[model samples]
Target chain A: MEFDLEFALETVGPLLMAFLQVTLVVTVAGSVVAALLGLIWAVCQRELPTPVRLPLSWVLDVIRMTPLPLQLLFAVAIFISFDGYRKFPDTDVETIGMILGVAVFAIHYSTYMAESYRAGIDSIRQGQWEAATALSLPRSRVWRAVIIPQALRATLPSLGNWAIAMFKDTPFLLVILVPEMVAKAKQLGGASYQYTEVFTVAGLIFLAASYPTAVLMRKLEKKLVY
Target chain B: MSDFFQAISDYSPYLWEGARVTLALSGGGAVVALVVAVVLGLCAISPVAVLRVGSRVIVEFFRGTSLVVQLFFLFYVFPLFGIDLPGMWCGIVGLGLNYGAYGSEVVRGSLNAVAKVQWESTTALSMSWPLAVRRVIWPQAWGLMLPGLNNLMVMLVKGTAVALLIGLHDLTYWVEVMRKDPEVGLWIAYGAGFLFYYLIALACSSGLRLLERRAQRRLGLAPSKTRTTRATAEAVA
Candidate 1:
């Protein structure tokens, strides 16, 4: 029951490292989905004439309005059900479920990011859009040439904050047995009956992973006028 | 079909019991977090270099980490250090600390949203720092932080979903338990849980907003930052 710092670190450190890799994998995959679907959602919001916008909006709403655990559970159940019926059976179902969960995570978050983009886009001053229209610059060209980069740069600090959040949030995957940091912490804790050093080290690793970027963000925010 | 309604008809009491526990956990955790967030939020904006840096470090450290890990750390990990907390209290403290970091930022931002001129006026009035803060600054910050504080409470409710992981029988955990009953079906269980959560969240948010507006009426203040953060993060985002 006593805290043994050295022995605990020796035991749980490597395991936490492995789980941190799982966290990294989930973060990357989820970031990709967020970026891709984020852009799609952005485009849909801009080009509202498309018939698909309503359903897409509803899907995003469902994704956003629900909690991540419910989403994760739903994702796991759906993947299990769907995989049970079709696709190669028992072939990396956890991996599939994790990806789906991450995608759900991405979509859930990207709605927030989409608002950031919308804010950044709004910051362009309506005159710029008017000028683009006046110059006969196609709407697509205007967004590509004049908007996206600036919107992205303006959105970087906020987006980085969310990236760190998504990393922190990877722990919820333990419910599905994805073996991320918290999951690994629990495994190591139970295996050794020493949860103290294991989860403390895990928390420190999470802090290490995220704090520098936040410091850098504050610095970046000060550098930018807007 | 009949069994589904009967199960809910009978099991409604257990579900309500669980929801009450969830409410107590969320409600108590929120009060502790509110005081902590305000103090830390002010410390975050402290003129003293040491205070500001220390506060920032603690804030980022908590916010950057996972809530469930923090909860597990308290429950399972603390006992390894010879400190035992009951499961529900452990859950509450973990959630309070984690969401308190988020709340601190909200509080800090809303406080700063007050004008530099207001500070100048307090200085012009030749008031002591505490006097200035209590009389002039805090009222303005209250209007600003109210909506944000409400939203943070809602986010805390959402974050409480993680308690399901550590096997604390919150609303989500109970719904998860209900999912075991084949009579009601899994999706129905989950759907009912979602509906329960959405109703609670919607009511909490709308109630907070109503209170916020009432407070605004009493204070005669309207600030942009508080309104936007409340609208975006708490209710919608």
Candidate 2:
């Protein structure tokens, strides 16, 4: 049977376009948060005293120990109940909900990335730190000039994959009825009674969007000259 | 007082049943993933142009989509085309296929890492292709792939939660069901769910860590992560 291209386009056109922004915005923002905090965590993990480090580990552990969706839900529920959020009064609950959803996901992933960064950090030689020391490079300069850039290069493939995951995870915001891609399809289906076409189109659209990156990942994985 | 105990005592049966479903999905999916990985892995490395291109595209297609989305597609959409199947089984199949594609990549990567010299050595030993594969190649390929397989197994366990989306009475689904009671208390509903997932994930990770340690011991491999960090950390410090 032939596909209904026009019907699929009309239904998905708006939803896909809007949700695409939401997904990209959330992913880019989340990646920014993850990179900054994860880098800080990785850097501090080495030089910090055990007292500060030990408690920080516990916080990271709790974040890691929980599921992302639960954390998302918890963050939304807590934030939506706060006095400032309540005082804003005119704020869109759904936007607030979505941002909190993305933030929680970012925080959760950041902790994991932090650990991954630590692994990447530790993988660097002990001699490099001594050389930086011998050069009398200031601590911040050493980290800025030398350490973090290399650490992040190693972290990129994972961080990129997680960003891809974060992009896909925008659909989970549908649990809170945010108008994400899946939610858009759900709304269209519920309104138009065409769940099959709507959801299928949504998936295909996402597949279309994601295909380029996945292919690029495979290609870059190859051609490792070193 | 007895509320926490009652909550536990009441849900133990449901929890056990949920655990069983989780195990069944993970076990079935890992087996399917392994088979799929081997086939796709072989095809991915095959000299035949069509096989190579066909396997890469198909693997990429599955890996790009969300597993839950795929699970929904299998459960909801296929039936529209008149392919009747149980939702749980669809979830099983989807999880298997989704992970299979990923496992295939890991498989290919691991197999590729085997030194080129081994094949020459095997050829010199006068072993046939299949024999060499069975003896020299498979063991080394397996040794390299085991850590990856271990990681994938942990994912498959976590992935079992997607079953909840397809209306499976997995732990997450049941917990949501149980929590529907206003008396279940939001904290209890969520805390229980969190605890269950954490325990399962912990169990799976520890099991994987054991397997990884075992693989490292048997094959005596140091994970590359160790050295890369050592070099960089020293360079900066």
Candidate 3:
């Protein structure tokens, strides 16, 4: 029950480096998926026909409302159940789990990304659309040349915010045993019975990564606002 | 399909009970978060430098870390310090403080959004600071804050799913328990859990939407930009 500073440091200090790699991998891979898929979602929500829009909207709403853990669980369960999954060699299963984890992370955050993009798009004046039309620009050209560039400036700050959020959230993959930093911390804590120190180190690691990034993000947001 | 039905029918009662616990935890956490948000939010904007800095540190520390770690810390680490509490309390407090840090920003943002003249007019009245804030600023800020707060409440409801790790028999836990049964498939179990969470969030958001409309009506800010202009007009005059 007592704090053991020396033991905790010795245990976590080495393991943190190993696990930090996993965390960074998931964050980078997931960010790519989220940034691309989220833009697609945002564009589709605005341009798709009513028949497509109505159901897609409802599906995104469900994803947004539900917890990520449940979604990740669903993904893991479904992914591993395939006959091909069993046939895959060693480490493949875990690799598949990591991929599914990224998919879930990307999918979940994309819903939010869509909302921010929509807000940015909406903030664009009605006059912009009319001007594009009066210029006889094709609809695609209007969106491409006229709209998306302006929308992106507004979206960058929010996208960066969600990236930071997704980075912190990568640890939730531990439920599926993705071997990220917190999972590593938990394993060390369980083995050594030094839950306080190990967990404190883990929290510090998260803050160290997130806090400075957030400060930079606020600065980025202010810069974008101008 | 038949097996899914059998699983649902078999676990329906347990699922209902777990859903009740989930709702209770989320509802309680939301209330706790709202109060903390108001206090800390006010503190963050207070004229006192120490109060502002103190609140900022607390808010950013909570915001920077993952909620799961916070829960783990409260549930696992706190007991070592002789501050042991039950799993349920840990869940409530952890969720409250983490989300409250977020909600405080919502509160501060909306408060700041209130016209600067309102604050000047309050100063002009020579009333106590609290009275001026309560009467002059809050009415305008409340409407703006509702949308952000409603969004936080939805996130909090989904956030309660972390309680499963701490061994609370919330909706997610019940779903997990059912999934362990050979008869209950994983899809059925986790799908039901997702649907339950979605429904609860939908209900809360719709309720908040109603409150938002009413607040806007009271402020006479609804039905477009004219009301904003009127407010600006008042500020000018």
Task: Sort every candidate by lDDT, greatest first.
Answer: 3, 1, 2
Best by lDDT: 3
lDDT of 3 by residue, A8-101 (tens): 7886665578455678778878877887887888889989999999999999999988988888877877765665476766656667778888
Error in Å for residue B235 of model 1? 17
Summarize candidate 1's per-residue lDDT along B208-228 as a digit string, tens digits: 787777768767666233334
Q: Is candidate 1 or candidate 2 better by lDDT?
A: 1
Which regions in candidate 1 have their CA more than 4 angstroms from the true location?
A49-62, A83-86, B1-10, B47-54, B215-237
Which 10 successive residues of model 3 chain A have the least lDDT summed?
A: A11-20
- For each of the candidates, the C-alpha root-mean-square deviation to the true structure, in angstroms, is 3.5, 4.6, 4.7
Which 10 consecutive residues of model 2 chain B have the lowest summed lDDT? B228-237
Cα shift from native, residue B62, model 2 (Å)? 0.3
The DockQ for candidate 3, computed on C-alphas, is 0.50
In model 2, what lDDT does residue A48 have? Answer: 92
Winner by DockQ? 3
Candidate 2 CAPRI category: acceptable
Candidate 2: C-alpha lDDT: 0.69
Number of the candidate with higher TM-score, 1 or 2: 1
- Candidate 1 vs. true structure, TM-score: 0.88
| Model 3 Cα lDDT, one tens digit per residue, B46-138 | 889999999989988888888889999998888878899899899899989988888888888778888999898888889787897788788
